[model samples]
Target: MVENKASAPGKGSLLQQTRLVCGLTLFTFVFFHFLNHALGNISLSAMNWGQDIRYVVSGKRLFPWIFYTAMILHSGLGLWKLAQRRTLKMPVWEATQIILALLIPYVLIKHIFVTRGAGELYGSNISYQHELTALWPNDALWQSALLIVVWSHGCIGLHYWLRIKRWYRRVQTPLLGVAITLPLLALTGWISAARRLELSGNQKLNVTAEQKSNLLEIVSQVQLGVYALIALVLLTLVTKYALGMFQQRISVTYLDQKTVKSVPGPTLLEISRMKGVPHMSICGGRARCSTCRTLILSGEASLSGPSKTEAQVLKRIGASANVRLACQIRPMTDIVVRPLMGHGKKMQAPGLSDRYRWGVEQPVVVMFIDLRGFTSLSEGKLPFDIVFILNRYVDGVVKTVNRNNGMVDKIMGDGVMALFAVESDMSSGARDALACIQAVSKELEKVNEDLAAHLAAPLRIAIGLHGGTAILGRIGLDGQSGVASGLTALGDVVNVASRLEGVAKEENVLAAVSMDLITAAGITPAQNLTERSVAIRGRSGPISVICLDETAIVLADFKPAS
Candidate 1:
């Protein structure tokens, strides 16, 4: 028997929320630090002015506690997450983030101790002037490296956190520009300040040998502590794996009937990764995306219920009772499940709801447009010329479709697939499609006139329009924020439409529109066009269609159904 669980309303897991808040707080500090460094490009006084303002804000009694708390919590949580991973096999960006994060303490500890630690412990007044003098010519490389590593790690974290959001995609390009430019300016400013300090006599920080030695000792100890903590996490993971080897293993059966056995501790996603199975985890198993959700077919009693965070995500996506996040579920007994989303497939638009993004059967008008004789026309032309002509032709078709309220679903070489009424009723979509065909004819005329010198003859195209129920949904990379994915219609209707376009090409007519579309649009064929029952490839029965020649197409009339 399948156990059904109800979804609960919640925000997210407490650990994830805490990690995000702390990460944002630390990122704010790093952003300002880079800005302060950038001030050195103007002059040493400017850098000092900026640092003074920074100190005024961050040095407040309450602010330091917030800052230090955020720093500690953020770092600690990062380590905890790393320790939780069942497998280190991950994307390059994830690996890069981990490597850079580990390097941060080693590169930053001495700087932090010499500056903030020295100020607190030894009453040392360290200024940008002293810093520049000390860092130039010898320690500059490490300081620059520190700047890059810290900034990159912060940006990567922020990017992954925000990339799932729709609004973030709109501003990602500008944000990326800022991310790149700000660090470069800061590095330039640091070098500029250092060069200025070198021109003048190098000013050393006023510190006694004993104070310096004490700070160095503290830095060393802190570094050693970081190493120890990392080693402990690694050892714990190794120990856990060794013990798991002795534990009873459980079986997970996929939709393909392939079964894999693993220890009960790891999540289903981790098990897939461990066994070299392909699984989608767009948010890197952070419980941030619903792409990794699966439908449990059996042995539901073996799996625990969804956590609050998991339930929240499931509710947001409107998953059924048997659906569970693969990244969150750990099955203790043998179970059969199927991943809902395909691995490496793009998800629907970010703005769309799960029902629409994933899929829904709906009535839609599918149209296919293919250019005629374009391949032969391009046989002798230069590649550049061929591309130019194709672009102009495609531009005309796309514009006409959009003008008539149609969605250009896919553009293949010299062919185009469009859908109408995806958001409206079938009748309205059919009307729009009918109007689009006329508009496309007129637009192609204009395109031909414009490219008259480039073409041997006037450009021609064949169109097929069919309206019926098709599965409408978005497909593409999950969490791509709508950049690389789009809505599409799939079913027999689409296939029939494509085949009808071929019929038009074979018959040397302007279009072969299905009677289904004409009736849906409430239009009567004004011209006496021959009606034919053509058997579409891959379809069982013959479809009734009217082939419209160029003259008959220009004379076609449309009227709305009452």
Candidate 2:
């Protein structure tokens, strides 16, 4: 019940930060390299111009050193990550990027050694003309394959990095344009440069027969080394899987109902896939998207602190210590977790699992309204009369809440818990909560007139309103919502609002409003308002409750008074 006291951002493990920096730098270099190829689409001569322009933009040896360093560091770290991974169960895009990155050094090593090595070993400058002559007709397929590998790898990495940003939505269209256009342009340029050099018949790299033989030997050794590296990787994966079979399996309980069994080899997200458990994951199990986050209820001991990437994700979601990304959580022991989303689905939603809807966290205004003294007043009334009066109260609360775009969360005997801002802004929720209270007050006044003979006095209600983040969902849990399920929320903020309603009688006020709701609504509290530091249960500190009189209510604009 205690809230997560947000402290300064904890310094997460440095591995992911270093990986991101390294990957970003390599991606920048790859982008420029692709752009250079794209220039060939204009002309082989244009391609030469692009090379000059590139040099001018990225000054001399300084840029080259940084580029090569980043490339080596990124590649090395990637292999390290590949080796350290507890599980290979990942999203398709993430898997694609890893596969391409690993294959890059193998597919690309021969070409680099042939071109750059010529200058170093043979003391000969390899020009664009020679490159074109060699690759045009004979090795065109190789060139295309390398291009596909590197470009796709870079694209997927950039997408994962940028798509999480707040500004990504604004630039989504422009990014899409480049994503579709660059590949086409780069391929055209590569072919054009090669074709032009072959037609001109000006491509040749002169060397002695002994030098050629040495080059052939070097190439063969490099090729064999690549084979060895790939074989090593395969050996490692098989060993891990084989050992895992003999290792211990663990059980994870989802809520209190479903239990999934796994061999501690795959992550919770991966286990969900294996067991056919429906879970919400927008970014495939990649840490880039935090949708696969789950709340740990009774198994904190079984889980460890998150990895650097998972820490970053949790920070982005404003998640507490109890929450973790299901994709990143691989428990060594039995655990209990609850999927926070996948409830209250509408028929119009997308994806294969259209049956369940996604839940969301948002600022909502919670208003609890209690019919004052209705329980005592109903004691001597006829059974039908009590039912009639309760029905009237329920009708008023429902109509007022619905008209203001709010939903009645629950109705117990003599009170109602209503929620606002499930699909709207927090400010709107605040305004609507106040409006509903006012409307219900008017409705009760009419009810008093209609039942003047049957009732001893006019009906009065006590309302308490507070606003903050609430997790909105639709589920039938603990018999809270009826047999036919309905939308609901559970949070300390809502509990505080309900508690305030219970204390309204002690304070001798009709309605109690928290300053948070007033601030969110941008409303000015009246000068005549009664201020009290009311201690509410589940709250760490006392809330400043402001009670408004009838006159103050009519004139109040939700703005604070000077």
Candidate 3:
């Protein structure tokens, strides 16, 4: 049996959480900055008032430290992530984000130095009036350009981050509406504010030649700092790659002895990329999605299990035992595995899709039908005849069940455990079950006549029906899904129905049904439906059941050889 267990909490999630928090912090700054820009729709003075409030929030001693720290850390981690990636080929949104992220530091460093760094480092009070005079006449084109670049990058990041959530799709339309409207408002306000400043003639040109040179020096230094950061990241990556080439390259054996060699500790996905293998990863190996799950064909005890983050992703898709995600796992030992979901296949949760549900209590009409005298009839027949007779009986039973909107859950030897109301309510389940028996009644009349020579006697069947709540789900040892998964109902309802069928065989009745089914179906029992109290096995007391006599629904009267 394959066992899929939920992994322990708080494993291998710190980096992801850190990135998310830092990203949100940076996104928040851009959002509020745009809002401050939007305040220009009222007036330039209003925009300055809003900008002052922004300053109160972010220009304070602690806030500036935090803001800059978040920016630098976020940028550094992003560069590190980019450097660590095995493949540049990815989804369009991911590629777009990476490109925009690279552009942000390059374009925004100059502005950051002037607006935030100038005030702190050089005692330049870069207030709204000072900034507006500088931006409107000096660098209005660059300011507008940076606004578009920053807003697009921020919006894409926010959308991608939130889209993974289940509720994201529910409100995606309205959320997209707000995403579009905010940036438009911001741009409109920025243009309006710049226009007002450009038109006003009373602008004080406060900065001297020395101060301007100092500002130019600061911007150049900031640009150099950005270049230095990128150079450091690239150099580190090259060094790591150079070291990795010599660092004990180990080949992990996959199915058919296909080997992908890489550093011993990187993920299987990393190795696959190193070997140019097309492994499926919808979320670009972030472990945010489980498109890269693999089933371990061997090395269960030898391989280390999944971390909590990998386990959590596996758990959501109902993955079974021996299945591990390729993204989060860093294999140390050579192991054999096969990918669960392949490239170009529409991926969902691997182990179980939405085809069936289980472990829930729901009322259902369970009908057990057993064919009697099969052994006696087939005693002198050839093996093929016996198999053919059994198949005919099963076929007839299945046809009748389907015609009545019932499902044949399982076949046990000469008996079939059929379920009713799988797609309907309890009352409809009872109605369907009744119609099934009547359908079987008519089917038996033709089957016995058709196979009369193969039989020593007529076919006899006892059907039992009971309706109540049962715990239903798919159970199986096969995790590939539905191959061995069997629909089962484990409750007193199924047990009582089985016992009732036994009573039917003993008392020579055509069918037996509990009072519960009769009342639920709103069927009035006929004169032939006699009430009886039968002591059932495993139950404390005798239960009231209605039995239909064989004479009322005898079915078979023809014989081919007679």
Best by lDDT: 1
Q: Between candidates 1 and 3, which one is better according to TM-score?
A: 1
In terms of lDDT, the poorest run of 10 residues in model 3 is 1-10
TM-scores, each model vs. reference: 0.66, 0.59, 0.57
lDDT of 2 at 4: 18
- lDDT by residue (327-411, candidate 1, tens digit) is 8998888888988876433333343333445455557899999999888889889999989999999988998999888999999
Pairs in clash, predicted candidate 3: 358-473
Prediction-by-prediction clash tally = 3, 9, 1
Q: Write the per-residue lDDT of candidate 3 for residues 13-47, one digit (tens) a residue.
A: 66767776888898888889889888888788898
lDDT score for residue 251 of model 2: 88
- Highest-scoring model, TM-score: 1
Clashing pairs in 2: 41-189, 345-357, 522-558, 523-558, 523-559, 523-560, 524-558, 524-559, 524-560
Global Cα RMSD, each model = 11.4, 8.9, 12.8
Kindly list the per-residue Cα lDDT of model 2 for residues 426-452, writing each as its tens digit.
776778888776777778788787778
Error of 3 at 210 (Å): 1.2
Between 2 and 3, whose TM-score is larger? 2
